[model samples]
Target: MNFIESELLRIFVGEQEKLHHRPLYELLVSEALERGMAGATVFRGLLSFGLRHKVHTSKIFELAGELPMVIEIVDITEKIEEFLPVVEALLRDSGAQSLVTREAVRQWTT
Candidate 1:
């Protein structure tokens, strides 16, 4: 398979975080799809932590809803860069963390 150089944007937020009463992750994915992004994925982490230094995990029964969630979007450099401002705005009121990195990726079709 052939791979193309691209940008990978990862957004870190809690499962319980919301924007205008809707789940943050869901809103982000919807926005990415609407913007015609290459692809976006949301992962539910079993265990994780952030700048708060508090461990969030799904292992504990009471901590279920507060588990960490990661949303990853990968696409061409220009597309990713253009979409970054929208993402920043989305996280502005919510205070979520985002990370971007350069990577090589390939899309496959059957």
Candidate 2:
């Protein structure tokens, strides 16, 4: 049950956000892998809101596909720091709204 110490970076964005007609989450994961990140994951939220305080969900009555999505990457502290600016630039260029958080992680691999 031993775990390795690492750093976790989480990015919150809307599912409908895209760049060059590509989903932002897919772009993020590709970028992370290309940069040799240890791992990256994307999660879709059933219901959520952001800075605008607008709610988005996957309910049958909803009119849009803009659900909340989160992309998470984990690696060493130095690597995460180095990648932060790159992520920021991507967000800026894409005109996407996102929230990023850094935290300590205990990871285990088989």
TM-score against native, each model: 0.84, 0.89
Candidate 2: misplaced stretches above 4 Å? 60-63
What alpha-carbon RMSD in Å does predicted model 1 have with respect to the real structure? 2.2
How accurate locally is residue 84 in candidate 2, as Cα lDDT from 0 to 100? 90
Q: lDDT of each structure?
A: 0.81, 0.87
Query: Which residue ranges in model 1 land beyond 4 Å of their true spot?
Result: 97-110
Over the full model, what C-alpha lDDT does candidate 2 score relative to the true structure?
Answer: 0.87
Per-residue lDDT, model 1, residue 62, is 89
Give the C-alpha miss distance for residue 55 in model 1, angstroms: 1.5
Number of clashing residue pairs, candidate 2: 0
Highest lDDT among the candidates is held by which one?
2
Best by TM-score: 2
Per-residue C-alpha lDDT of model 2 across residues 5-101, encoded as one tens digit per residue: 8999999988888999999888988999999999999999888777777888788456357787889999988889989988998898789988889
